[model samples]
Target: MALNEQLNKFQKQQVKCQSTLSDIASSRTSVGPSRSSVPAAISQRPVATAPVRFSNDTVRLTEINNIRKSPVGSQMKRVIQLLFETRQAFTPEQINEACYVDMRANKAVFDSMRNNSKAYFDGRRFSYKATHDVKDKMQLLSLIKKYPDGIAVSDLKDAYPNVLEDLQALKASKAIWLLYSQEDIAYPNDLKCDMKIEDDFKALFRNKDVPTDMLEVEKELLKIGLKPASNTAERRAAEQMLGVPSKSKQKKKKKQEISKRTKLTNAHLPELFQNLNPSGSQN
Candidate 1:
């Protein structure tokens, strides 16, 4: 009985050791491999990811949100007001810093102002163009008189909003003269020096049957005791009209002729060889 009890105790101890070993094996399996077992290349390799791209609208919205966090009212109005108050030009970045707004948000305002012709942009800077003080015909006339060479009508239009009506009134009263060229210009009229052209002269100019030929025109001028233009400029213009080449063109032709005469060719080689052959024969 003592021997059988000792044998049973030994068998129970062995079974317990086996169960502990099995539990350890199962735990190891559940935990996965150790860090040391992973390959070095895979462990060190960088993971690939897709790059992030934002659309124009998303970027614009983000910029607006970022800028709108400030206490400023309208970004555009603030920029314009700043420019007007300072009466100076500013770049988008400068304007942003001055108004404490983002440049991206202000750019849209600048573009809108430019498109609407409410502001002036000289490639890099923006300025309020309608800051002129002229408000009526008298002021407009005074402004015109200040510039003897004349002022551009477009500039006047910018200076005074209702400048067109005032300009017509001034012209009717002979207070100013409008000269049309590539651009319309306003010149202050001096009635003392202004000569009235006869209606007959205007009629002659407007007549379709009036001679278009230069010689016929010259004859009419001669009949009226008026001499045709005899200045160097007039002569050159006449020469151009007659299809005569200019002095520069004539010089170019002369240079070409001289070059052709001086140029040596294979055709001259035979003569040169003949001259040399006579000397060779004498030798």
Candidate 2:
């Protein structure tokens, strides 16, 4: 009986050892190495990822097909291309129709492109940068010519919000005229009398030419704020201003020549009379 019990005890001990070995193996597979066992360099290393980037030409091309294909990227390219090609200020609905993309769904795409592509394109609420400049140059001069009373700056801003830069450029070149309001005048001396008479003098000044006749020149001078005949006795002032020689000066020069001719004729008279009558007879 004792021998049989010892054999059973030994078998149970062997089973316990096998179970302990199995548990150790399972634990090792389930939990990996402890944190302390890991090397300091391996534990502290940062996770790496691929860099995100877009091509510079992505913003420049005016056709969707020109850009690499992607859902958001293709839509953005289409929107940009449409804006560039039409050269028109568009409403959100118009943009939707034109690009065939939903502004709501692609808000992120548009926003991203707008932020990224400002140097290449400036897209505003109702206007685009490139077209605004062209239109302003084409229309501003003609518009100024049409409205001699002066067009309101507010009206211009509303029509072309992006046009301030264009205006500044034209103004700097003196190609466009500015009309100051009474409120804008800091002092009475600051008021420009000539510009008041003509809202834009650049156009008028360009149209006028120096007339040949002093009288006609006088008439044109009157139209441009030069005082009429009686303002003062500044002789030939208009001619001098026009860079022309005065008619009076010309007349005086001609008279001097005629007087010289008369004096020469008188001097020769005695010789001719002597030749006709050698007896010095009076005829």
Candidate 3:
């Protein structure tokens, strides 16, 4: 029994020593001074290189010609802007198609803008213009300057809320082309689509509880020569004062009107004379 017990203790010690030696061997293998313990070798790292990607193999022009272009030139300033505004320059037809709506609906405004925009300047190209088919921000600002009371930032945004970039550009460029915005206002209860620009603007202004900033705008507009409407009640006053009164339309042609009057007058007179006169006179 003693011999068996001694043998069992020796076996346990052997197992423990084997475990400790195995740990030491692992540590030595990881960080070794002797090359023979673990053979030294160098393997390729096989690094990941991004696949070569190539695109649009063209050089771009950064500068522009200083000499202004003719108004009718194919590459005039705004047209050039329209070209570079997006990924590609738009075709002439694209520009035309955008502005060629029923412009007669706002003939007074469209004509004024079209005629005035021609003399205005473009910020980037530093060129003068004679015509602007599109209702752009700068052009709109010029009109607002002429009629300061008639516009606002909200008015401009409502006019073209979809054109965020244009509004942002106006801000970034520090172009003062508009009346300062009053606080957004509630719509009038009795809203009408055909309200005159002045009336509509004032209605919105009043409904906003009369924002304090509006006082400055009102003063600025007055300074710039925008007149308050002589009378909001006088819809026809402008036409009347200008002697351009619109005539009421008549459905019948002048010849048809004359014929109808002649028939009526002749019908009564002929019956009376036929009863009193001879056959030859009647015929």
lDDT of each: 0.65, 0.52, 0.40
Per-residue error (Å), model 3, residue 261: 95
Question: Any runs in candidate 2 off by more than 4 Å, and if so which?
Answer: 1-69, 116-126, 131-283
TM-score, model 2 to reference: 0.22
Give the higher-lDDT candidate: 1 or 2.
Answer: 1
User: What order do you get sorting by lDDT, best first?
Assistant: 1, 2, 3
Clashes of each: 0, 0, 4
Candidate 2, residues 1-283, lDDT tens digits: the string is 3323443455565566667667766775654667568788975665342343333433332232223235776676666666656556666556655654555445676566556432133344434444223355557656555555555555555335456676666666665566577521111112244354453664666456657556676777789999666432254676578798644777875544432123345552243223332332333
Q: Every model's Cα RMSD, please?
A: 27.9, 24.6, 31.3
**Top model by lDDT, which number?**
1
Q: Give the alpha carbon lDDT tens digit for every residue of 1-283 in model 3.
A: 3323443455565566667667766875665555456434522333233343322221110011111111233333344344334323233234323322222333443244344433332321222231322257766545444542343345444333244466556545544332333553211122244466676675665456433344455665577999644333364676788898565546433323332123345552242233332332332
Can you give the lDDT of residue 75 in candidate 3? 32
